[model samples]
Target: MKSLLKALKRCAVAGAAALAVVSLQPVSSAQAAPAPVVGGTRAAQGEFPFMVRLSMGCGGALYTQQIVLTAAHCVGRTGANTSITATAGVVDLQSSSRIQVRSTYVYRAPGYNGDGKDWALIKLAQPINLPTLKIATTTQYNTGTFTVAGWGAASEGGSQQRYLLKATVPFVSDATCRSYSGYGGLIANEEICAGYTAGGVDTCQGDSGGPMFRRDSANQWIQVGIVSWGIGCARPNAPGVYTEVSTFASAIASAAAGL
Candidate 1:
């Protein structure tokens, strides 16, 4: 199997303009085990610490009381008996509240490769009491102005954060993101890009599976994407790509039982 970053790089080069239509490989089950949780300060506004921390280790999102959205690459490769857990309402990993997963649903796109259509859903053992994020399907995201929050490393080759870190970034056009040869145009229709031209304010290792949110016309927050991969943390012209939540609106609704 190819490294997530390597697969993304291939997709970028192979189909730079049509990356949104590519299919990627599912994440291996052996690599799906939960990772250590990091702690940090809560975001000031439009921030959800629970959202970032719960799936940082598993690469998932809290979509409903019992639903979590994650990358197929993160869970599909696991065995039927594989167990996944989620931690919520946590600002400090050492002593934060958490929830174990009762079940998980990995939605593998037909003909999955290491570089295309990597997405999945996980069901929690119990419904969480915290606020759920609203899903946005309308094409409200475009160039400029967006935010990505996660528990990945703060810098490329840097150590992971102890707490959730939220970064402000701008969305890049498909044409711009495609220019990178390594991604192999793996960016598909159900994806979007966000980050800086200079290496800063981007998601790095351990940030996968987090939410990339945008404000809709109603001024309400909607989850637009799930963290995917990047060449590096906030590398110039190498914005991080995410599974476009809006594109999978029906799938998410269906998986969550219309949550």
Candidate 2:
């Protein structure tokens, strides 16, 4: 399978395969499980109740009691046949306390042209009382310590993580982020960059559709970005790029408010 992350990489270059999709492969136990969030540590149980694993092989954030916010590319169209299920309320995929919910409603942001703005909402069959991450209307995330969590591979081409992992990444300005070769004119206003220029930490495959967020003054976690795409898993000059959450706050509210 072609690396879904190659979308942003090869697209920015000439004569590339040109697949603008990111697909998650079902993790097999036979393959060694590396870790989640490169250069990060394991998250304590229940640290993030909103974090969930999509049975379709991706991660998501429970935006409300019944609505889950994730990347638009993670699942197919929202309809009766949308058979995706979410396992929530647990840190480990193997946890016995995990709650499963089938997606009864799905909405992919209409503005998702794939250049950026890759976000979606999935409504659960039933609501579950779990901590939720609010979408930020403020872009105070100019530069600060952001946290990204997922069950993705710890490194590029590495195995998927069995347990959840958390990592701290510093925000990189658009000016500095575009300074890298092959990335100029590729960074969109709908996207934000975070990580070290030297490369050490990032969210890899299977981590797509997950949240990249930070704490606010109210001591609450607010999502600022969604793991959308990257050139590779934590490489120099190529940091983790995400769908700027603030840009889509209205879109999110409009889609999820009435439901």
Which residue ranges in model 2 land beyond 4 Å of their true spot? 1-39
lDDT of 2 at 98: 83
The model with the greatest lDDT is 2
Please give the lDDT score for candidate 2. 0.69
Estimate TM-scores for all models: 0.75, 0.84
Error of 2 at 103 (Å): 0.7
lDDT of 2 by residue, 70-178 (tens): 8887766655534878888877777788899888877888856566767888888999888888888867754577788887766666666778888766666777667
* Superposed model 1: Cα runs more than 4 Å off: 1-46, 49-56, 77-82, 96-111
Scored by Cα lDDT, where does model 1 land? 0.53
- Alpha-carbon shift of residue 223 in model 1 (angstroms): 0.9
Query: What does candidate 1's lDDT look like per residue over 61-110, in tens digits?
Result: 67776777766655554323236557666544455354445554444443
lDDT of 1 at 96: 39
